[model samples]
Target: MTSVGTPPAAPVTAEAPMRRLDRRMIWVDAIQMVISLIPTVVALAVFKVEPRPQVIWPAALVAVLGVVTAVNDLFRWLKTRYRVTPDRVEVRTGLLVRSNLSVPRDRIRSVESTANLKQRLAGLRVVTIGTGRHASAGEATIELNAVRRETAEELRRLLLRGADRPDDATVLAELRWRWLLYNLVNIWAFLTAMFVIWSAYWLLNNFGVELDTWVLGLADWEALGPGVTIAVATAAVGLIGVAGLVIGFVTEFWEFRLTRVRTAAGTALRTTNGLLRTREVNRDDNRLRGVHIGEPLFWRWMGAADTAVISTGLAKAGMGAEPASTILPRGPIAEALRVARLVLGGDDRPFEAPLRPHPRRALRRRVIWALNTTGALTVLLLWLDLTVEALPGGLWLAGPGVAPVAVLAAVVAYRALGHTVHGRYLVTRSGLLTRSTDALDRSAVIGWKFRQSLLQRRLNLVTVIATTAAGYGRYKAPDLDLHDGVEFADRATPDMLTPFITRIPPRR
Candidate 1:
């Protein structure tokens, strides 16, 4: 097969080896087969009165899928080849259409290891090497599945040997049992719970079983008023969400650890977490564009927040939106700030600087947007009330109630609008319920984009977006006075905006 880069050729030197995954992967595949069938078996036993063909067909289909996966894994194991050199690690796989994946030693952003119960029992772990390349989900991850624990450890050492900091690494934060409670307050935990609840209901319904009996538990439908029934159902759904949050957090953050190591290359930020399937990721500090501190309303009330670094080449999947950037999982603002400073190599001015508030027109604009959104909902509700006979009476009232909420949100949004340039950092703070403060490094910004809508032009408002290769690419200071926005952009990156901006002074 071809080398990682399209050079003429490179031999698989014995310094590493051209090897397949551990033979134990066969057993891992077998365990997966059993795991896949568990839900079907439980459903068949729980709902015995359900149609036999309906339940049996699903189980058969699952079996077919399992077999396909098992066959694929087997062939994959047989065909896969991996070799590590001083410069790079490459993996070649496929029976028909071959693919070679490689990560250069310098470009390698993270090397992660994971093992489920089955893999652990089989003395194997999954090793993934990441280059921090901007790719779709799973594209950046190079997996060596079901490898021996010793082999995995050796690979980690080889990949990270010269990457370690010349100075001692700092331990920012260790896993704390008390801090896990913060997970419950996160919006994602509730969203996941809702998805699970929906999926379960859909599956049961498709199988000709009513979930209302299980969830509502034989409530007297006629005796309970509409509001009472709705309240009960909501409570039941919330309980399910709570259960899901507990399970999810316990599994994901079992022994989470975050560290910052000063390496020869730069400051290396490393994170290891997850219980059932443990994961560890390493990223260079220099790649970090800024820090994204998130404080959801509930967590904010509790004086807790989540912090993630804004960095390119980091995968923003599997955990949350920006998993690689996450420094403090869920902790006090003080703790998050401490970690952020460590990641930024002792630069604390960004966090300490006072932010400049946006113009009053910014607030007006926010209120107008809010009114437009709520007004649209009100119209939709009115149309439904008149057109749909089966529509709920409460929904009509709900539309009007949204007006008060929209107004409150607009005020909060106005309060949240602020930005400032602190030395080398261009900090922008926004969001109401999930307040975010992005402290971006000025040097990382490659370009600027100035946008003004018709309404914004009338109000002399402009949004200056700093474009960088890292993090989310475009970090904005939105709803600023036109000149202020342009000045801020020019100040943040000296001489970069001079060519694009032309100022005309007012005549006396």
Candidate 2:
């Protein structure tokens, strides 16, 4: 077993010795494997499957696979070795096909340390070093799994160390118990619960359990009317969703804390959170371009919002994982705005600047689209009634009834469109379901793209997109006057668009 100790402060050289990961990983892997097989064992017992060759062989095969996995993990741990040098961090692994991966220390953008319940109990962490560059597969990042907690911390500081050191860290935000209430209002909670319910039904059916029959048997549909049945089902689903939201919120943000630390390189924002699965992410301040304030319709109604970073190194973090750019989770909108200000160096101008509303033609376009949809639905329903059997007496009303609602939605969507340039940031707000206000650094704008549909061309409107390296690559000001959009983009980045644009007089 490698001795887990505090790493020395000696300057690393090319000749520095490579170190092995903690040997405890082998035991952790073995235990996890055993735990995973418990479901198979339970299923066999529940089904009362005889100890015959057919059932026994498959069970034995599963056991063999688990053992093989454990052995492979053992070999991987024994063969893997890593080292830190003055200019780069390198890792070598594989037995027959040896592979060595190295990332320049200067290119390191963020360092994340994570530990699940099992790894935490084993005093280990998984350290991931990220570089903002886009590369094929695993080329841009390095993962060191099951390293000693102290060793992970040491590597983070060493790889990110700078020439100058500064003062103590400042606490930017901490978890508030009241913030958990916001989780209950999330649409994702119900969606997740429904998905889980469907998965459970599918799994039980696959296991040869008549899940549908059992569900049907639980309720007497004739005794309870359709309205009562729907109410009961809705209540049940709501209860499950609420419970899930509470559990997920507590586990993910139990001890959440965001801090601004003055590192040798510069200031960095660090977030530490989670209960059973703890995570610590350190992001360099220099990489941060701006902030994004998200306000979903439901959240906005409740005066709640979330904040995320418009920064490099986080664009790829959302691939099958929780977003790494989310600095502040769903909370009061005021708190979200406050954190955004702090992240952008206490500049309130980005959020406070009055946004310029788009041309009225934009609203007209939305209304026309909505009316077209209503017409399509109405025609379809009428066709169905004339050719097919007579519809329910009130069913035909649905088509005409949706017109007012759709038109109202169009108006709301139009109200959401706005854009402005504030200080060092170009701010844009759009979307009806989830309004996002992005304040991107003006200097980060690499180029501008003007998109116009056939209809938009007729209306003299265009969607202005500001392309940047940070956060989603581009931010759009949907449905703006064509001339105004070009001028806005030109002013935001100054000389970059000046040569390409012909100066047009402002419309009177």
What residue runs in model 1 are displaced by over 4 Å at the alpha carbon?
1-16, 34-51, 163-167, 186-233, 262-264, 318-322, 375-401, 499-508
Give TM per candidate.
Answer: 0.83, 0.84
lDDT of 2 by residue, 4-32 (tens): 23233436765889999899989998898
Q: What TM-score does structure 1 among the candidates reach?
A: 0.83
Error of 1 at 304 (Å): 3.1
Q: Could you tell me the lDDT of residue 316 within candidate 2?
A: 64
lDDT of 1: 0.78
Off by over 4 Å in 2: 1-10, 38-65, 94-99, 135-140, 162-167, 191-222, 317-320, 346-348, 373-402, 503-508
Clashes of each: 4, 0
